[model samples]
Target: MANVTFTSPRMQRDLTVYAVAGDTHTLLSVAKKNKVPLESDCENGECGSCLIQVSVLSGKAPVGMALTEKEKTVLRYAGKITQAQIDDAETNDRPPPWRLACQFIVRHEDILVTF
Candidate 1:
């Protein structure tokens, strides 16, 4: 299980929800299930409206998840992540701070998400 905490200025308080690791559910789905007000224009990775900042809270090295091609293009175009960051994520297994909630899969590690 993973604890995903969401924080946003639009919300009254922070919300934390549990997500099963390797469940193949996106973070956006988890947020929607929990009634978290994460704004998303498109459920797919094509849009960057669901972009969010994720921080690892497990006090351990974060396990990197492969980013989709759409995510790479969208994030890069939005100036949320650079090519160097993407390369680091792919090569060093280090995830970038910004990610598309629709494309992010929750791992066993706890994380804090900010929009």
Candidate 2:
């Protein structure tokens, strides 16, 4: 059981921060729970189509931290990805490479996600 939450951005009402289990976890969980709009075409990391930004809580538990090699390749075609992002994933093994939302289970708190 994780704590899921969402915080609206300062000015934009539609632009909000979605927290799954209250942390950087899965978009599928939060999207499903809050009914956030999504178009999960492949549902796998193969398409980089469901890419969403998320911020992990400080000192948060390590949830889904590594992208499969295949996912990394998809990200290569994701367009406009920075080496910094790749480095970030290298360090944490989770994050940046965009996890396959359908592959991992939810387990995190206080993650700031934008929809």
Candidate 3:
């Protein structure tokens, strides 16, 4: 299982939810299921409206995962992540902080997501 903590200062509340590990569901799907108010236009990975900063709360690495090729492309185009950051992530074995919620899959890691 994975614990997902979502925080929005503008909303004045924080939400915590659980998800099955290794599911095909993306973070945006989980948020929608739980009624978390995440702004998203295109649920696909093309739009940057669902972009959020992901932080691993309990894991060996901050991101604890690598970006998917689609995520890399969308995030790079949205200017949420840079090529230099991608190179650094490759060298350091961690994902970039910013990610598209539509593309981020929950693994067996606890994550704190901020938007």
All candidates' TM-scores? 0.98, 0.57, 0.86
Cα error, candidate 2, residue 84 (Å): 5.5
| Tens-digit lDDT string for candidate 2 (11-95) | 2344344344435545665565666555477776666655555555546655555566656676667653556776776786556
Give candidate 2's whole-model lDDT: 0.54
Per residue, candidate 3 scores C-alpha lDDT tens digits across 1-115 of: 9899999975668999999988999999999999999999988877689989988888576644677787789889887889988888888877888998998889888899999
Candidates 1 and 3: which is better by TM-score? Answer: 1
Candidate 3 lDDT: 0.86
Residue by residue across 38-68, what tens digits does model 1's lDDT show?
Answer: 9999889998999999999989988998999
Reference-based TM-score, model 3: 0.86
| Residue pairs of candidate 1 with colliding backbone atoms | none
lDDT of residue 97 for candidate 2:
27
| Ranked by lDDT, top first | 1, 3, 2
Q: What lDDT does model 1 reach? A: 0.95
How much does each candidate deviate from the true structure in C-alpha RMSD? 0.6, 5.1, 1.9
